[model samples]
Target: MKTMESIENEEAAPRAEHQTETPLESLASIASVLAVGLFVMTFVFQNFEIPSASMVKTLLIGDHVLVDRISLAPPAKWAPFTFYRDIHRGDVIVFLKPGEPDLFLVKRAIGIPGDHIHLRNGVVYLNGVAQKEPYAAMPTSDGDPQHEYNPYRDDFPSIPPDPMYQVTASWQYELPQHIENGDLVVPPGKIFAMGDNRPDSLDGRYWGFVPRENIVGRPMFVYWSFETPADQIEKQSISERLAFMGHILVHIVDQTRWKRTFHLIR
Candidate 1:
């Protein structure tokens, strides 16, 4: 017969083996789940980065954003997609170029189809009425000079509130007037979009309305963020060099927005 000590030792051996295997199995399961999640995010939910200061105060440059592709039903007709199931006024979005199919862009959807949009004096008007721009933290300063008045003309009129930021053709009064100067109207099956950074952004004022079909998806959140170089990411010898040069490629690999990393896009 086996001694009590011997039997106890035998039982302990299996217990130790099982304990070791459980952790390994759990780790494997975790890795598998993580891989699946990444796949889903790539196919269903896409990510983007803010390239310009166009949508400043609202969306800063270097911000990492998430775009939702699942919401956009596949293409249907020449116009494309299930049309629009439902798109709100304030929802920020990502999309392809209605004019240049090769381009991708992000901007806040301001006016929808059938809305008469333009700058009256210095304010934004929709359908002959002014839109209540709560999001417009900053407004034109003074003068009939507020918005970009004439395309043929260099400066129409504008008065920046801050004396330091005064008005002139060379000054900040210059809004990105899409193709022509002054105000533009949105057409059917298209919407007008503008960036928060009025003076610096090249938006509807330059390219015109974005076609409904070009809309890729709504931005749900800012999943990840990084501070990368303008030259873009290339293989570097060190992390410091990468941070400066080889760094994160927001437009196209890695950047150091350590503070922004994993930070929620709001």
Candidate 2:
């Protein structure tokens, strides 16, 4: 029943204030908010993606985690010698990878200052006592790769001569015969950490202890997660434009794991 002039006038009417933002404007506002979030996240809380499965079960691939940044310093981008707090065992931490300053890694605290640690049959022992690790949700079954890469070595790819290799029964970091429990130092301001996936993890064992300053932040929680299609995760791809587009759409939609939406990262 509306006349053409009336309809045109109605269409020309000003929109609500909240609805005035254009798509680009909405994007800009979102970006501004994200920038503010990053500033706070970098200095206050940190956001990271679990790109690898080294900490699987505790942290999964594609899981987004947040970390508190008030505690660590020294090597972090913030300020030097500004130790706001202390790191503790059992706390999940993210750190600048030892030896490789360019890369960052996340793991759980296993050894502390002055704690003698050893790996027996690929199990961790603290102060000569077997420390039960409950966070390792999956049963350890993989064979140890003895030639694990030691990053600290200038040779780069050569394996280090660790005493752990000398054990006759199983894989373990055999403490020196004379190095008593007190000699097992994590140093004055260093921490020893390992991934929950012990066998697959490249951690303190391969690169030496991580300096306290190298720590990035403690992982907070899962903010976002992406699902890998059981078949597509490891699938190789083509370089063609149309083919690649088809591949990407299939990868995103078919792989969208509905059950994992908003799932918390442990």
Candidate 3:
């Protein structure tokens, strides 16, 4: 028969064992959690910030958005549960800039593959039909005699583009090849993207078409919006971004766009 002291020791032994876990075991648990988080962030969703005024009233600078990466992900043979929806016209998308692959850009998808796109008097026409753009910001040119109308902004795809609206050299070379009956024909595997604030944007009309593979995802909502200038938001380095986040934390009340926070992106 065990003595009282022995029984007490037995109970204490289990308590001690339960409390003591090896450092390696603890590390493995942490690593597992981190791995899952990283996988979700890389393939399921990601955070993006608006760095320019090109999307203006629709998406303002300093707006932090959550993008659903899975919706546009390439189909995987091994992942049967994964689903994909076609990218339709009028969908706002975030994609890698054609000229600068590292830079991510957000714009409305104006033309899909094989679409005949054009613009006239600052209005977009897709497939020979005028698109209803209720979200476009105030027009920069209100027929002011002092403000010279930019041909490229008011009218697009003139055989010999106006020198005033000189496009990128690469786009200049490719623009003519896609012209069909005066409209810019989007080639297969490419999409034409433009900003809601057309007058201030340097989009497909300036750079070139957005390749299929370059598209990242569609923004689900504005998780947070801060009143910050375009120049400050353009800083992309890790240290710079961290510093900017810290600034937001300190000046949250004053800089936060409270009305826009948690706003759904259309």
| Candidate with best lDDT | 3
Clashes within 3 Å, all models in order: 15, 3, 0
Write the candidate numbers in order of decreasing lDDT.
Answer: 3, 2, 1
Residue 67 of model 1: what lDDT?
Answer: 74
- The TM-scores, one per candidate, come to 0.59, 0.61, 0.87
Tell me the whole-model lDDT of each prediction, alpha carbons only. 0.59, 0.63, 0.85
Better of 2 and 3 by TM-score: 3
Model 3 RMSD in Å is 3.1
Root-mean-square deviation of candidate 2: 8.9
Candidate 3's residue-wise lDDT over 61-101, tens digit each? 88999999877766778887887876889889989999797
The residue ranges of model 3 lying beyond 4 angstroms of the native Cα positions read 1-12, 142-148, 162-166, 233-247
The model with the greatest TM-score is 3
Worst 10 residues of 3 by lDDT: 138-147
lDDT of 3: 0.85
lDDT of 2 by residue, 101-176 (tens): 8888989888777776655455566676766777663333344343243232212112333545332221133223
Residue runs of model 1 more than 4 Å from their true location after superposition: 18-31, 71-85, 99-102, 137-188, 220-266
Candidate 3, 124: how far from true, in Å?
Answer: 1.3
Of the two candidates 2 and 3, the one with more favorable lDDT, higher being better, is 3
